[model samples]
Structures are given as C-alpha cells and as structure tokens.
Target: MMISAATPFTLLGQNLLLLPQKAIFWEQQKALIIADVHFGKVGHFRKAGIAVPRDMEQSDLATLSDLISEYRPEKLLFLGDLFHSDMNNDWDWFILWRSQFPSLQIILIRGNHDIIADSHYQKLNIELYDELLIGPFLMLHHPLPDIQLQHASGYVFCGHIHPGVSLSGRGRQSITLPCFAFSSKQAVLPSFGKFTGKVAIRSRLTDKIFAVLKDKVIAID
Candidate 1:
C-alpha cells in the first residue's frame, strides 16, 4: 500500500504546504503556487552557445510531477516567468506536462519573460492574468511599490525577486536559501527554477519571514 504525503503548515491565516521540492500548496484555495520556473531556459542558453546543464529542464519537470502526485492540487499558479524565452523543443515537454495534468488548472500571471505567442498558451489552455483575486489575496507576478501600500486593498502574493537570506558562519557561509517572505501587505516567494539566481532581502521589524531550509521552513524574528 502507498502512503500519501501530507501537506505542511499553515501560516499568516493561510495554509502553506511545503512539498518535497520548493513548491508550496495552499489548501484552502486548492492552489499550488510556484515562481519563476524558467522552463526551457537551458535550451535557450544552449541555443546561444552557453554551456548550461542539459538535464535541468527534465529535473524541473520531475519535481513538478512529484508535487502533483503528492498534493493533487486543483490548480497550479505560476507566479512568473514560466518559460525563459520564446518557444523551443522544450516547450513540447511543457505541452506534454499539461496533458498529464489535464484536470489541473494552470494559470500563468504573465511575467516579463513570457513573450511566447498568445495562440500557444490558448492551445495549452493555460489562463493568463495580470493579477488575480482569490479570497482575500491578490495574486501577481511582481510586487507592488511602497507608494501603493497606502491604497492597497488586500494581501498580495507575488514572485520575481527570488528572495533569499544570507546566513554566514566563522569558516562556512551559506545562504538561508530560497524562502516565502511575508509581510503585512505582501508575500514574496522564491524562484521555482533550478538555474535561477537569488537576491538577499531585508525584512522590516513588523515583518514575518519564513526561511525555507533544506528539510523545513524556519520562522525568523
């Protein structure tokens, strides 16, 4: 008999389920939220004669498969940059992935890098949105400015920054790794892409941050 993998914790009045990979599942919303997958990026790099690893794309998809099998989320929300560049052979792999999870709704909040033809997404049946409202949250690919905070209406969930924290020691230094950074008005997620880079972020005194570590997510005060 096979045992089901249980979802993870609840945070900030939301059910934050941490899968084995870096993806997060929101139980109440029945959505799996991931960021900056940059699928087909390796192909893009190689097309330009850059020596990036070839297996990165396949490995990325495999991780998605694992998460899907484990949580069975009704929808998969890509925060941004689903594909790195224009469509390529690697895109068919994504099309095949869409077929594998036919019943699973795929929504791409169009990020800056999503320059593929609209017809292609239409063929794949993936919904495109500049921003979305689900419950009390406004889902977007990029974060809003501080000036907009005064007029903000709801909690914002966004990606694109690929937020990480720096953790250093006497002789060893390793970043706190990718994280789900939360504040009063917004929450920023780590990039879902394996080949993407991370940026260190500074949290405010009133902010609540969750640093995603190797095994679990740790709360930082």
Candidate 2:
C-alpha cells in the first residue's frame, strides 16, 4: 500500500509533513508523530457486544505498516491514547506489528486514556514518558493550559480532544474535517484512529489550520 502525499509545512523552525493518514512526520528527527490512535477501541466496543468487525484492528496495523514503509522513520511517537482501554486481544495484534519493526524506536507520552500496565508496554520495548523534550518541541498527550504555555521553553506538540475544523460550503452546507491546529505555542494533531471522534477547535486569526480531506491536507486560509 502506498501513502498519499503529505502536506509540508514549517513549524517552530522544524520541517513537518502532515500526512493524509492523520499523522505528522518530522523530517529533521526522522520521527513519525501520531496521536489518539486508541488501538484497542474496536475490541473494547466488541467486548461490550457492539459487534464491530474483527478486521478493524488488522486495518489499523496495515496502515501503520504502510506509513513505516513510506517514511522509513527511525522513531514513532504516540502523543497519547495509544491504547483505548485495558488489556485486550487487540494488544496482541499491536505486539505482532511491533515485532515487524524491531529496530524502530517507539515512544508513548502517557495520555488520559492510556491505562494499560507499564509492564505490558515494557515487554514490547516501548519507552514510556509523561512528557518529553526533544529538539525545539515538547511532546505531550494533553495540551498545556494558557498559564503553562506562557512559561514553556519550547513549542508543544500534543493530541487529545481529536481536534478538527468546520469548513463552510456554498449555501448552508458545511463539513467538518480532522485538522492540524497550530498556534504559536502548540500544535494539536488529528486523531490517528479511524474510530475516534473529532472536536472542532477554536483558532485565532493568525493560527495555521490544515484540514485533512479524503486524500490530502489543505490549508483553511
């Protein structure tokens, strides 16, 4: 499988590629940054007798494999919510996926929904952190509050809330799309999981907002 072309932009002096797959690739660091994957979400729903398709987990894994093959990133960073719930059968799929890229460094910044045991992640060789500072960005799961942003030393890359933007069309019709919300202090990535919901965000006039369409990412102007 081939990945669609990613939109390239410069943020905080770093080159970033916003892929149509709802992920960001940091060219300088060779890192692929994604958020809110909620890996076990389907299983979580099915466990409750919701009757989701069994292949949903496999699809997500295949997408990840395609992205890894396309970008060849040395590191894969999950901003947060790497897993949807507690241990489930879906975790086995993730473990198998990880095995394919044993040399790829995987990092997870703890998020609100990440409740799995540390031992489980450790066994898979995934490094866990509450928050991480690398280069010019501070990677985190939740966005920093206004007060905290004022005192921060570097730009922040975060997820959670599954940020999106509303685009008004002709007449009264309008559509909402997942987006990359970039303010001066921080940037919120779109949710990488197909099953997640998106929350339209409020952005300043000067903020850069890129909406993810079916096969591409476009600026909101």
Candidate 3:
C-alpha cells in the first residue's frame, strides 16, 4: 500500500517528514518516530465483550509495514503507548509482526498505558527508556511541564494527549483532525493507532500545526 506524500517540516534545524500515516521520519537520524500506537487496543476491547473489528489490528500493522518499506529507516522510535494493555491475544499478533523485522531497532519510551512486563519487550529486542536525548530533540512519552520546558536542553518530541486541531468552514462547520502540533520548544505527534482519541489543541499565534487529512498532511493556516 502506498501512503500519501509526506510533508516536510523543519524544527530546531532538523528536517522531519510528516506522513499522512501520522508518523514522522527524521531525515538526519534515519529514524521513524511515532507515538501512541496502542497496539492491543482492539483486542483489549474485544476481550471485554466489546465488539470491535478484528481486522482493525491488522490494518495498523499493514500501515507500519508500508512506512518501513517506504522509508527503510534505521530505527523506529515509539514515543509511548506502543501497546494498549497487558499481554493478550493481540500480543501474539505483535510478536509475529516483530519476528518479520528482526533487524529493525525498536525503542519505546514507557507510557502510562505501557504496563506490560519489561521482560516481554526485552525478549523481542525492543529497547525501553523513560526519556531519550538524541541530537537536538528529547524523545518522551509525555510533554514536559512548563517549568521543565524552560530549562530543557533540546526541543522535545512527545505524544501523550493525542493532539489534534479543529478546523472551521464558512458555514460555521468545524471538524477536528489529528495534527502535528509544533511550538518553539516542543512538538506533539498525532496518535498512530486507528482506535484512539484525539484532543483538539489550542495553538499559539506563532505555532505551526499540520493536520492529517485522509490522504495528505495539510498545514493549518
């Protein structure tokens, strides 16, 4: 499957490709940065007697595969929430997927929903970290506090709230779309999972917001 053309944006002098798949490819680092995948979410709900389409899980994996094929990144950096819940049948699916890419370096910054045992991730060769500082960006699951941002060493790339933007039309119609929210000191990525909620964000006058549409990423004017 082919993804829509990725939109390029510069932050802290680093060139990043914002894909319609709700992920970022850092050009210099050759890393695919994504967040809030919630891999086992569908299964978690289904197990609880909530009827969710089982194909939804496979679709997410397919999109990831497409991104990997398209970019061939050296590493995949998951800001947080790689899995929705603890070990479940959905985990088996993830295991099968991981086996297909044994050479890919996957890293996850532990998120609130990431309650799975460390040993499980270790067995899959996935690196775990609370926060990672690489080059000019600090990779984290949750955005830093206002006071911490004041003294932060580099621009932070985080994804906890599943940030989005509300767009208005001429007839006072408005819709919220997942977005890449960029301020001077931080950037929030959209959730990379199909079954996730997005919180519409209030942007500043100087902030740059790129809304992800069905097949493209568009800059919000």
Candidate 4:
C-alpha cells in the first residue's frame, strides 16, 4: 500500500499528480483521488447473462485498500460511479469495506450510475455531493460540456469518459491505454475501475497528456 509521492503536474491553477494505479494523488490536501470505480459491474453484467469473473469486485476493493493503507490519506475522494448499480449483494462488500478504514474520510460525487438510495451511503458516513469546491478546483462526476466550460468558477476535474490513449507500431499492433487528459478548462481522469473499457481520446498539440501503464505513468508528448 506504500507508494512514493506521485508525479506532479499543474493543470489550470492547481497542482496534481498522476499515480501508478490510475489514481491521482492531490498534494495540497494529501488526498488520493480517483474516478469511476464502477464497483460490482462484473456482477451486474454476469447477472444479465454476460460472462464475467465474480472476483473482480474484490480485486478492485483490494486496490483501493492498498492505496489507502500506503498513503495514509486523511481524505479519499471518489469522482463518481462508486457503485455500478442499485443495491445488490455486491453492495454488501462495499459496506464491509467502509468498516475496515473507519477513520479515513470518504466522499462520493454522485454519477449517473449511482442510483442507490441515500440511506445506504449515509450508513457508512460517506459524504455525498453533486459537485464540490476544494481549494481552486471544481470536482464533479461528469465533465462540463462546451457550453458550460466558460462559466466554470475554477478548473474542473471530472470523469465519465474512461479516457484512453492509442499507441501503434509498425506491425499492425495497436493498444489503447488509460490516460489523464488535460485541457485549458478541465482535466479528464482515466477510469479507476479495472473492469471498465477505455476509449482513445484525441488531444490537441497544447494538451498535456499522461498515460497510465502497469508499472508507471508516462507522459504523452
């Protein structure tokens, strides 16, 4: 769970870092921030007749646990989609998880996929917000559309794209890997959920991009 300091990058006016495990380690608040965990998604698919490994939810939880224990963060922020669906047996796993780290402050920004009742999250004492302002940044579950970009108070951090970057070689080999994409007004985080799919995002020449590989995070020139 112990990780070295994240690689810092400046977006808009705030300082941020890209972590190894597809998460962001915010320096100012000493918080580990991640987006779109989509827990229990595998189960949701499997129950609908799609084949999926049942152990995925546990693995995802383990990853979060490792990050928390390593960083010993005072706060943890989930950008959205912490839960993939309505209350199900898989939700019990999440409830149990909340007990393990009793002192870690948890916050969830509700995403479109978050349809569970408020009572469930309240039981775990996880604070819920449609969006929030932390320092100079505006955190939300979904990225602002073009029309809203000009009106934003500060730089925005959001998810929902599950963004990735595509790499190609001479041998017809191509790979799309998750990435952090920064624009003038906002930054889009790669999905934190291991089971989620990614779409390669096209970036402008001035855009700052970082790709998350298995062992480390690499900048995209």
Candidate 5:
C-alpha cells in the first residue's frame, strides 16, 4: 500500500516490484523476497583477518527493516545464502534484530552457504526449506538451466549467482550492474548483501533484465 520508487514488473500475471534494495516485493503474496544476505560474512572474514568492515553486516539488516516498514509484508523470504559462514559474532546481532520483528514469518531456502544446524533457526522460529512452491512461484536457492526448469514445479524464482548485467555505453565504456534476469520460466535475483559479489550473466534475446541503480530500478530488456 505504500509508495515506492521501485519498478513494477509483471510475471505470469503476478505483480512484482523490483526494488533498488536488490530484492523483490511480491504483490499478490505480500511477501518480501531477498537473496544472498550473507549475514555473518563480515564476522567470518574478520575471524580470518580479511579486514572487512564490522558495521557492514548490520546495515543490510537495517535495510531489510526499512523495507518491512515501508511494505508491511506478511512474510520475508530469503532465496539462499542467508549466512556466509557457519557461526560468527554477527549471529548475535542477527538474533537481536530478529527480536524486533518477532511476528514476521521468515522463510529461508537453504543455500550452499547455509550449513548452520536447523535448531539455530528453529529457536528463532525461522522456517528452512530446500525448496518451496507458493502461488505461481517456486522458490529455490540455485538457478536451474532451461532443461531442468522445464520440469520445475512452478515458475522458479532463484538467487545464487548474484546476477548482474554488463552495459556498454556509447563511448565504448562498460559497467556491470546488479540485475533481475527473468526468462520465460525463471527469474534470477541479485544478491541482497552489499558485501557480496555479482556475476554478470548472458541472457537470451527474449529474456527480461532490469538493472538496479542506487535509487531506482531500470528496465534494460
């Protein structure tokens, strides 16, 4: 019900808002879809002397909180890679953040980096699933190829590669921007974590790509 600068896009007759936060707001389902937050990444690297910023991890949580405040979504869904490592100091921060939105349902589609024991999330009332089908969308952590997608239970929404799009300017300059890449049967979301990296993807002619800018989302397909 709140206004947003996010770009509205429709898929399979369902309305979606492509957010500059590198996430999606599914209209019909009233769910906020995010991918690859990598909650403990900073702390994980710090343990190994990687020298990443200590406050960077909390900022992502703050962004999620802002989105929840604006959208008032009924559920928050993470496509995958919710945690960058097993357990770290940042986990405590996450626990504190979880306390604020105790009533909000959190669902995580287990990604490769999600190796933490289920009990940890269970105590917080966070539901974990290998894959999920809600409405016309199938939530998955890893993107599937066309061959496999043909057999998907529903139109797949995945986020593991942290998809980006390379744009070449008129002067031979090129920049890679995080993007939402949607095919006929699947859509790959960009990583929601600021500390994560993006992998530029090659899209087919018919694919739809929306690049995420600092304050808005732009359609490039």
Candidate 6:
C-alpha cells in the first residue's frame, strides 16, 4: 500500500497534493478540495426500492473525517455535487458530521445536483457560490472549454464529469481508472464519491494525468 496517500504536483507556482482519496490539498490555501461527493446517493437509490449499501455515506464521511484530522485544513472547498438528490435521512449524518468540525469553514460551488435550498446550507454555516476565484485558481462546477479557460483570470479547478483513463496491459487486459487530468488552463478533478460513475477521458500529449489507485496516486508517463 502507498501509505503516504499523496502525490505532489505544482500548478501556477503553487503546490498541490493529489490524494488517493480523490481529493486535493492546496498547500498555500490550507484547504481540502473535494468534488462530486454525492453524499446522499445511496439513500436516493434505496428510496427507489433498490438495495444499496447503507454504509456508503458513512464510509465516505469517515474518509473525509480522516483527511480532516490528518491535514488540519482550515477550510473545505467542494467543487460541486456535494449531495446526490433531495433531502433524505442521510442528510442527518451530514449535519452530525458538520457539528464535529464546527470551526472548519465549508464552501460549496453550486452544481446541478445541488438542488437543496440555500437555507439548508446556510443553516450549517456553509458558504455557497456559483463560481469562485481563490488565489491562483478559479473554482467552478462545470469545466470551461480551453479557449475560455485560457482567458480566465486564474487557473481553473472544476469538476462535473467524473474523469477516468483506460489502461492496457501486455496481456490484452484493459481497465478504466479514475484520474486527475491537468491541462494548461485547467485541472479536472475526479468525483470524490465512490458510488459515482467514471467517463474515460482522451488526454493530449502535453497534459498530465494522475491515475488514482486503491491507496495511492500514480502519474502516467
């Protein structure tokens, strides 16, 4: 296992640590970056009379808690899709989780799946934004095209598509793994929620791709 659970990469003169947990850490900002968490997804499925594991949300929350304890980030920046859909019993878990980290500022960039009323987030002391320009990065729910991104005021960090890259072996085996894709103008983060699906991405020669493994992240050469 890759015990460190971190891979360092520098962007726009600032340092970023890509983590196996499908999150990122902005060293200068002292913030934990997560995208597409879909917190209540399992509950949504179960609500439809489908059998889904009840521990999924708890597991994801536990992982987030662990990261918080280890990094001690002052703020939590969520790119988008923080919750799956609607207000469900699973929301109570989030409320309890929020209570534990009363001092840690949580910020969410509004996304399509975030249909919950603003009052709900406000009640938890969470800040909501359509888009945000923080330091050298512009945070958004949907990633912009390269043309638009080039003219953006800052390097972009966004997530909407759950990105993945296909890997092939000498034995004709192929597998798709979630990845962190970095282009000259933007960085598309992988979905942090394990219950989400991944879409394979075709990257350019100059782009950097970091494939996430079970316990570590590896850069694709």
RMSD for each model, in Å, please? 2.4, 0.9, 0.9, 1.6, 1.6, 1.5
Instruction: Give the best candidate by lDDT.
Output: 6
Expressed as tens digits, the lDDT of each residue in 8-100 for candidate 2 is 999778899999999999999999999999999999999899988899778878998999999999999999999997989999899889999
Tens-digit per-residue lDDT, 178-214, candidate 1:
8777777888888988899889899889777667765
Q: Which model is ahead, 3 or 5, in terms of TM-score?
A: 3
Q: Write the per-residue lDDT of candidate 3 for residues 45-90, one digit (tens) a residue.
A: 9988999999998999999999999899999999999999787898
Off by over 4 Å in 1: 1-12, 172-176
- lDDT score for residue 114 of model 4: 91
Q: If the candidates were sorted by their lDDT against the true structure, best first, what order would they fall in?
A: 6, 3, 5, 2, 4, 1
Q: Write the per-residue lDDT of candidate 6 for residues 59-80, one digit (tens) a residue.
A: 9998899999889899999999
What are the lDDT figures for the candidates, one per model? 0.82, 0.92, 0.93, 0.87, 0.93, 0.94
What TM-score does model 3 achieve against the real structure?
Answer: 0.98
Q: What shift in Å separates residue 166 of candidate 1 from its native position after superposition?
A: 0.5
The lowest-lDDT stretch of 10 consecutive residues in candidate 1 is 1-10
User: After superposing candidate 6, which stretches have Cα over 4 Å from the reference?
Assistant: 1-3
Q: Is candidate 4 or candidate 5 better by TM-score?
A: 5
Candidate 1, after superposition: displacement of residue 5 in Å?
Answer: 8.8
TM-score on alpha carbons, each prediction: 0.91, 0.98, 0.98, 0.94, 0.97, 0.97
**lDDT-best of 4 and 6:** 6
Candidate with the larger TM-score of 2 and 4:
2
User: Candidate 1: RMSD over Cα atoms?
Assistant: 2.4
